[model samples]
Target: MKTPWAVVVGEVADVKENSPDLPLKQQYYIPDEQEAEMAGSLGSPTDIADNGGYIVLRTAMAPEQMENLLRSTVHSIDPQLPLTQVQSMEHAISDSEAPRRFNTALITSFASIAVLLAILGIYSVIAFSVALRVQEMAIRMALGSQRSGIFRLVVLSGAKLALFGCGIGLAGAVAASRLLRSFLFGVSPFDPLVLTLATISLLLLALVASLLPASRAASVDLTEALRSE
Candidate 1:
């Protein structure tokens, strides 16, 4: 939709209402000569048109190399002119995105630490449970439980716990997706691909954590385990 500013603009070449940062406001662009003449009549004389304008150039060479040349060229035209915010396109983009990059890295670091702790916790719990069940395992082995059965028993138990945890987490994420909708960028809060990858990663880690204990249970010394009781 057009606003009262359309009078000054005459007609817009394009609109950028889709931009998240831009809001409905009075904004228009006009030629520098017409603007200067208008401003001169308003006692805000724009002499060399140094007050505003954007210089966009494309070059294969490094942007840094152009900075000095651009500044000197501008100064050569008018010695009193000052160049402000002279930065490369890459630098401008990086500067604008610096905060988001820092936040993502910080959150990722915490998530990694949380995953590592979960893996350690899983390993400890399964190992302790196996230790406590040594006598039961020994009796089972003596009563004709095969080594493969023992392995399956431990691994399957851990798998159940892992799957249960993932289910709970996925449910919680879905419930909170609305609350988190604004914070996510480039991806949806409930993006299925990301969620599936995360779930798979946790399950794999949990299975890895259980492997040592499962192997220990499967190859355990039946006589020692029974005699220790």
Candidate 2:
């Protein structure tokens, strides 16, 4: 195979035909004569080289019809020739991506559960704080504090904690992204838009979680809350 053959490299092709993660490497396209020479050295005929190769055909026919036609055509040349792994281009791409898709889905499910737990934790902490400060809230309203002020106080308190946690989470996420570089395609590990969106979503949910506690604080019965203390 190393023997020199008088052949010209007609063209050069560059493609990511397999996967984007695959490294760029050289692939030689030698002529039939060179192939035959290599095959002879390996104690095989030139036709062995042609035993496996792809045939792409574009047609208006349905896949089933096209497959039948392809089978008939190939068998016409040699009835014993077998056709295997017959599928459309879309199917081929999907098949190749199946594993990646599964991993993405599994990660997404776990991420969703983690976010839900975070929202619940925020809600519980804010609700507990509101419960403990019920008399303080009642006294403030009894004096001159507006109900709107109490509501804003509670909500803003939760929001501050949420924002702080979000900052730490963002830092952690940026660090963790590098681990997922191999699984990612067509995007950077540190995708700013995605990180921003995730942070915003968590913050919004935290605010929503704070709403119930804020409402209860604002609507406290001044006489009853003060008497209880």
Candidate 3:
């Protein structure tokens, strides 16, 4: 803003980042004394502000006690003067963070459930495939196919499916990045590190799930398998 006749100028402060939740805008700050002086010049000295102000106190006593003292002191001058929302800075900051914290918790809970379901679904599919292919695994053993080879074959099958899922999920996430941006704080919606870590976790779980059935297949008794088949 300019002076009364647009004749004076104000120095700009260094650019600084603001809270993510707050929208971008142009705002200026002036000392309380200068603001009060400006108000007095307007001929409404008692109009000090938009009838709103904050009083901060550093005290050993609890905030509730300090609030009572402040209210009584203000009332002694004018009983009509009001005091409200008398809270410490700590409380104010905590209240501001409450919504963000709750959102994070809720998203985390849903993500965890999704991961669990992915793990169980992959395990079930791989286990069933291994069970149906037991005779084939037995024949491979009978024909001198190495146990390590069979293990790799089974595990790779599950890994393939997990990899496919990761690819689709990543693509969908990138496409919806704009929609997801509001829910993120201090993080990009399409953060590569986050995607990489999630992909790796899914692959590791897939590997573990495949390992159990693969191990069972590798240890098959060829003679008993041939007779049963």
Candidate 4:
């Protein structure tokens, strides 16, 4: 038994009614044997069923090449027939999905840049705060505060600021969800998993950013800090 290839046979009426956006003037499918017979008779008035009226080309040809061949054959049969819209199914599907992929890539790039800037801002603020409190840290050390205690205090302070900022950010994200609805696919704007993961990631990043400053505070020398002040 010869292997049969499945090709889509779109009815002219159905295409016109259902897909007004499509530019295709007419489309049909016929079997390979009937292709030559229909070639001479194309553009002639003949009663044909919508489902199985057309010729089916050999499966060896790509959809694009097959579409081109069909167009050429039809145009040769009737030169006056205006070919306004002719496209392969592959091209149609690709065109339909291209915009979505491009949008996703753009949004992902912007999100990455925003996260990088946030991390840098957190690091700078924590570093500056630690620098300004150097003398205070030195005094605490001199008075008998443990190094671990100083480190914990600095980290906690940074954590409090990060938490506050994150809270505000979360509120803004919630409000902006409506505006982002059109861009989202396969995921909800307020997905709990996404929000939870984002929160945890941001908190971890903030902690990492504060680590260097916290370490410096813990290592402060009481004698030198007091002498400098």
lDDT of 1 at 10: 63
Candidate 1, after superposition: displacement of residue 60 in Å? 1.7
State in Å the error of residue 122, model 3: 0.8
lDDT of 3 at 182: 88
Q: Report lDDT (CA) for all predictions.
A: 0.80, 0.86, 0.81, 0.76
On residues 72-91, what C-alpha lDDT tens digit does candidate 1 reach at each position?
Answer: 89999999977788877777
Say which candidate scores most in TM-score: 2
Better of 1 and 2 by TM-score: 2
Clashing residue pairs in candidate 3 are none
Q: Which residue pairs collide, candidate 4?
A: 29-54, 29-55, 30-54, 30-55, 30-56, 31-55, 31-56
Q: Which stretches of candidate 3 lie over 4 Å from their true place?
A: 1-19, 31-33, 39-49, 57-83
lDDT per residue as tens, model 3, 14-130: 443334466656766666666666555454655554677777789999888998888999999899988889899788877877888898899899989988899888888988998
Question: After superposition on all CA atoms, what RMSD does each candidate show versus the true structure?
Answer: 4.6, 2.8, 4.2, 9.6
Q: Of the pair 2 and 4, which is ahead by TM-score?
A: 2
Report how far residue 115 has shifted in candidate 1, in Å: 0.5
TM-score between model 2 and native? 0.87
Instruction: Supply candidate 4's per-residue lDDT for 83.
Output: 52
What's model 1's lDDT at 93? 67
RMSD (Cα, Å) of model 1:
4.6
Task: Please provide TM-scores, in order, for all candidate models, with all chains considered together.
Answer: 0.81, 0.87, 0.77, 0.63
- What is residue 151's positional error in candidate 3, in angstroms? 1.6
Model 2 poorest ten-residue lDDT run? 40-49
Error of 3 at 18 (Å): 11
